[model samples]
Target: MTLFGGLAGVAGAAAAVRGTSSRRISPYDLLLMTAGTHKLARLMSKDAITSPLRMPFTRYRETGGPGEVMEDVRSEGSLRHAIGELVSCPFCLAVWAATAFSIGFLFAPRFTRVAASALTAIAGADYLQLLYAQLQQSAEGTS
Candidate 1:
């Protein structure tokens, strides 16, 4: 809870310091950010490629999904365990990812949009790939 509070405090401070105002975000940008946040959170938390970053705090368990992996949080210490849990849970990481992109949008909207668009595209591609694989499997089974 302290960590979450700290994040909220930092975001609030940044908004005050930067004079950020209440501008309504467009639906397109909102969707892009949502998809981008989902992909970014999953990539950071479960993607096999990013395991090295989480290795210190988590132990590799098994393959999770297509390119994702399951990991157990290390119970070495409070901070480390907390970090491990945060990095291992996509639901938890989503908060951080959304916060980061929100901050990025505040600081540099253009760059944030580009990055978010790329992540959103990747997320779309991932779904398509899964659908394709499922169709192929069905076709093979029916043959």
Candidate 2:
């Protein structure tokens, strides 16, 4: 089978499993889920330090500034490889993260918010740190 077919099968299976699970996903929760997915996905798939974890499964491509582009994965013609691709892709992993968040939000709203808050807060902090460095560099260049 083609790689795209395998990827589709993995995603489909995940969705089917999620569908079978009991949960309530409201419009507002969907918004929170989207936000959470964005934050968590960034950390998991794009962070510089996460390279080691994905290195075995992915190949380093061009630099993505703080992170790097990963390719040549997910096509090893095996389920393990497909999972690796899923784990290495922010957009792909976001769906899984969002699904987990949906279940967590439904079953453990308090815990879910606390964890999401931590990650969201860290994401905010990361931007602020980058901004601070940029401003510092500008000042240094000006002087």
Candidate 3:
């Protein structure tokens, strides 16, 4: 994790040195990035479709909530296990997701904002879907 953070820091520093200095973050952009980071981290860490990417370092445990999957880290090697822990955890991967979006903002703000907006919309939609499902369940119970 330290290595990963160090590499991300180096990339950000290099980008800043190349004249893409840090820009003031707007509240809108901050919200978008937060939602984007959450969704992207969940997508990478828990989504069933992304399990293949984590397969090398993790073992499938069971189906997780909704479209997510539960995975256990392979305990063979330290580095591989560490990576497994990161890949299998949304909270852990959120740091990487946030850092990547930050770097993307430095390199290409417009594209980054667009991508973040899309992710935010998806996150919102996911919440709405869950709410809708809950309402349906409630209605059924009442009926």
Candidate 4:
């Protein structure tokens, strides 16, 4: 519980500081930040290079299509547990990512926009790719 409490305390402190200088986040912008954070977490947690960090805490199974694999986190109350909890769950990290991005927008709008735009574009591409694959499979079945 100390780990979680510590994280919360840090987050609260960051928020308190941010509140002093940050403007109110609009709903529309919040939506964008949500999407970007979702993509960022997915990429960060599951990518080939990064998965190794969280894989120890998860079950490894081949994705069945290629050399890809999936990680299913095994949760426990162990205080020394891995960062899989934070990295594996987009919901867990979204607020932090959004806050950082919001601050980025405040101080470095150009870089933040470029990075967020890239993440958003990659997210769209991911959806389109998945849709295309499903369509192809359906067509193959019909043929």
**Clash number for every model?**
0, 0, 0, 0
Q: Estimate each model's TM-score.
A: 0.92, 0.67, 0.93, 0.67
Error of 1 at 25 (Å): 1.5
lDDT of 3 by residue, 35-93 (tens): 99999999999999999999999999999999999999999999899899999999999
Model 1 lDDT per residue over 1-143, tens place: 78778977887787878787454567888898999999999999999999999999999999999999999999999999999999999999999888888877777788989999999999999999999999999999999
Which candidate, 2 or 3, has the higher TM-score? 3
Global Cα RMSD, each model: 1.4, 5.6, 1.3, 4.0
lDDT of 4 by residue, 9-94 (tens): 67556667766345555675666666788788777656655667766666565562222356676666453245656666666767
Better of 2 and 4 by lDDT: 2
Off by over 4 Å in 4: 1-31, 55-68, 72-79
Among these predictions, the greatest TM-score belongs to 3
Q: Model 2: runs farther than 4 Å from truth?
A: 1-32, 67-75
lDDT of each: 0.91, 0.71, 0.92, 0.67
Candidate 3 Cα errors over 4 Å, as ranges = none
Question: Candidate 2 on 85-122: residue-level lDDT in tens?
Answer: 77678888787687568657755777887777777677
